[model samples]
Target: MDLFIRYILIGIGNGAVYAALALALVLIYRTTGLLNLAQGEMALFSAYLSWWFTTHGVPIGLAIAFSILLSMIGGAVIERVLIRPVTAPGKSHLNVLIVMLGMFLAINAISQLLFSTDAEPMPKPWPSVSSPGDPVGRSARLLDIGNTSISWAVGALALTLIGLCLFLYLLLQKTKLGLALRAVASNPASARMVGINTSAMLMVGWALAAGIGALAGSMVAADRGSVSPGLMTVVLVYAFAAAALGGFDSPVGAVVGGMIVAIAESLTIGYVDALSTIELVVPFALILLVLLVRPTGLFGRRVVERV
Candidate 1:
């Protein structure tokens, strides 16, 4: 029981990052009606920028801020330069999908070319840094119960998740910009007819999603104590599973789905001897099971079209 509880606690932090990425996925899906397969690579590149900035004497806070800002700008630029042209009315969306898939490879390769494949320590932006001589986990230990404990790093990640949830809720539910975003997401043609800038909204959506991914990716790198070109690879898989389980169009569902996936991964790996070596399968299995019952996911709105 203690072991189970410990695993759950550990999983929560990882789940939070997955939730953040899943939120990004949902955002793009809702706004553009498309899945950006290169999301993980984009995030990895953004996180790498933060790492690079820190190495060049920038404060951690400033580095993260810069990363988020740059990612948003880059996302907007990508939409304008690459996505908009392909997404033009009556244009074949197949090309855009291909572009995204191509980006997945291109971005990863670019990351490697720009910043080798070497892994380096990522500075913590949440809590104080650990001493050089201290054991890796010692400085991060935050909560303890007998032989079980949760680290400060993990707790910080959880706090970040809470912050993101609140930010998203307020932005999507209470602001004018958010209203425009929602309007566009719901019906781009209607929004365009009503004088809303549908193209601009779509750009904003990509920018926002990219910014979220940057923040999540940076925090995840800090938590893992390392930054590398392939940092978000496996996490991306879990994130996609989370998005699928929650509903690609629901932010709240993304968070819930991420937590569920992480916890499932933890408990399954911890207790099931057979699964210990194949942890990645847990998320997909859960996805398949959930999808089998609810094709639109737990919170996804079912769309009915006239045939």
Candidate 2:
């Protein structure tokens, strides 16, 4: 029973991290009508930036902050220089997606040149809690469960997710900027007539998405005790699946989707022997099933063309 509780906690933590990044994908989709296939790469690049900062004697927290700020700016710049030109009002959105793919390639090549593809150990916030041999065994870290034994990482991840979700909700529901952003997303021409800069709003939207992606990357890498170019590969796919399952238009949906995916993955591993060996494929199959059944996703808005 205690072991089962531990697994549930761990699964929840993993779900929160997945949800964090998935929320970013949903944000871009909601605001720009483009699904950024390169969102994972962007997050991975930001994690590299944080690692670079830490390697240069900067504190981990400060490094994370700096990376987030820079990633936010990078996102805005990419939108202005690359995506904006390709996407115009009353035009097909396919070009924008293609440009994002091109941006993905450019970023990946640049990262390879700068950081190399080799995996490196990421600095952890709590490295002393566990050692090579302990009473609980190698599979479990020394988590504070009041003699019950729980995964500490899971608690931290859940708190982070809750805090971030609250922050986003406040930003969107209780601020003037959020109102303007919503207006622009709903109808750019209409928003422009009301004195809102639609282009600026789009840039801000992308910037926030990228910044959140950075946080997601940092959290996952730190928890795993390493950072690598390939780390985002699996996580990103899971995140996208979460977003699709939740309904792209609803941030709440993304969060729920993430939790569902994480639980599903955990259950599959725990119950099915064959799936235990190929865990990553589960999300891919689930995503295909969801898309085939719902098409617009669970929370995606239905579009109706007017003749």
Candidate 3:
């Protein structure tokens, strides 16, 4: 029983990371109506930035903050310089996909070129046992109960996910800027007529998504005690599954979907011997299941078009 409980906690930690990234995906999809295939790579670069900051003597928290800030700026710049031209109103949305796919490869290659593919240890905020050579482990316990213990890493992940949920709720539901963003998302022509700068709102949306990705990327790398150019690749897959399962338009659903997917993966991995060599298939299967059964997902709003 303790072992099962421990596995559940581990799944929650991984789920928190997935929820963070899925939140970013849903945010962008909601605000800009574009799915960024390169979102993970953008986050990979941010993780590298945090790692670089740490290597330069910056504290872990502050380093993550810096990474978020820079990633926000970078996101805005990318939107203005690369994405804007393709995503202009009346343009083919297919261009958006093509550009994002290109960015997927480009950003990964750039991060590797700039930082090298070598994986490096990242400093953790919570107490952890990690060495220079092997930088990730669940060593410090946050809670102990009989034979089951929760690690600080897991606690941090849960807290961060909760905090992110609150922050996003406040930002998107309670603030003027968020209201304007929502307006733009709903209809840019209507929003522009109301004196909102649709382009600026779009840029803000990208910036916000990138900043969230920065947090997700940094925390995942920190928890693992490693950051690398390809750090978010596999994690991105799970995140996508979470987003799809929860509904791409629903942030809350993303969180729930992440937890569901993670728990399912954990249980299957723990008890199913046949999946030993193909664990990643768990998320892919979920994705297929969700798509086939409920395309809009649990919380996603369905789109109705006049034919």
Candidate 4:
């Protein structure tokens, strides 16, 4: 039971990381109706920037802030220069998807050329420079009287995710920019007709998504104690699964779905011996199961198509 609890805490932190990226995916989907396959790579690019800044005598806080800002600009530029070429009314969605695939290859190649494939340990941004240097279980403090205990890092991450979610919710609910984003998402043509700059809003959507992706990358790198060009490869799978489980178009669903997926993965790794080696497959299987039962996802709205 203690083991289970420990794994749950660790998984929760990981889930928050996945939730961050999944939120990015949800944002792009809501605005452009396309999945940005390049999200992880974009995150990797930004993380590399952060790592570079940190190595160049910059403060960690400033490094992260600068990295996020750069990523936002990169996202907006990509949307304008690359994505816009393939995106047109009544055009082929396949083309836009392919463009993103091209972007994935392009970014990966650029990273490899500039910053070799060698991975480096990412120093912690805060005082906790070293992981407690113990097994994740032993590193956590036991509860006074119960079998449950908490991991400090996990607790911190969960709190951060909650705060971010609340902020996003409030932003969407109370801000004019958020309203315009929603309008762009719900009906681009109408939004354009109403003097809303749909194209710019789409750019903003991508920029926001990229910024969120950068944050996710930074957290994952800190959690793992390293940064690599491929750092986001595995995490992206879990993020996609979380997005699918929650509802690709719903932010609240992303958070709930991320936590559920995290818990399920923890339980599976703890209880299913055969899954020990192929643990990563667990989330995909669950996503398949969920989609089989509810094609629209757990929190997705049903859509009717007219031919």
TM-scores, one per candidate: 0.95, 0.89, 0.94, 0.91
Residue 251's lDDT within candidate 3 is 95
What Cα-based lDDT does every candidate model obtain?
0.88, 0.81, 0.89, 0.82
Report how far off residue 12 is in candidate 1 (Å): 0.6
Best by TM-score: 1
Clashes in each model (backbone N, CA, C under 3 Å)?
Answer: 0, 1, 0, 0
Among all candidates shown, the one with the greatest lDDT: 3
Give candidate 3 regions above 4 Å deviation.
Answer: 129-139
Task: Summarize candidate 2's per-residue lDDT along 147-228 as a digit string, tens digits.
Answer: 5565556666777889889989998889998898788777777999999988898999999999999988887877777778
Poorest lDDT segment (10 consecutive residues) of candidate 4: 134-143
lDDT of 1 at 242: 92
**Predicted candidate 4 versus true structure: per-residue lDDT over 36-119, tens digit per residue:** 899998998888778778888887668878989999998999999999988887789999989988988889778777765878
Error of 2 at 82 (Å): 1.1
Report the Cα lDDT for residue 290, model 2.
79
Worst 10 contiguous positions by lDDT, candidate 3 = 130-139
Q: Better model by TM-score, 1 or 3?
A: 1
RMSD of candidate 2 to true structure, Å: 3.4
Query: Candidate 3, overall lDDT?
Result: 0.89
Clashes of 4: 0
Segments of candidate 1 deviating more than 4 angstroms:
133-139, 145-147
Candidate 1, residues 1-307: lDDT per residue as tens digits? 8877888987898899999999998999999989888899999998889988998999877999999999999999988998888887788889899999988899999988897689877788865546666422223577788888777888888988899889988998999899999999998889989999988898999999999999999999888878887789888888898999999999988999999999988888888898887988888888888889999988889998879
Candidate 1: clashing pairs of residues: none
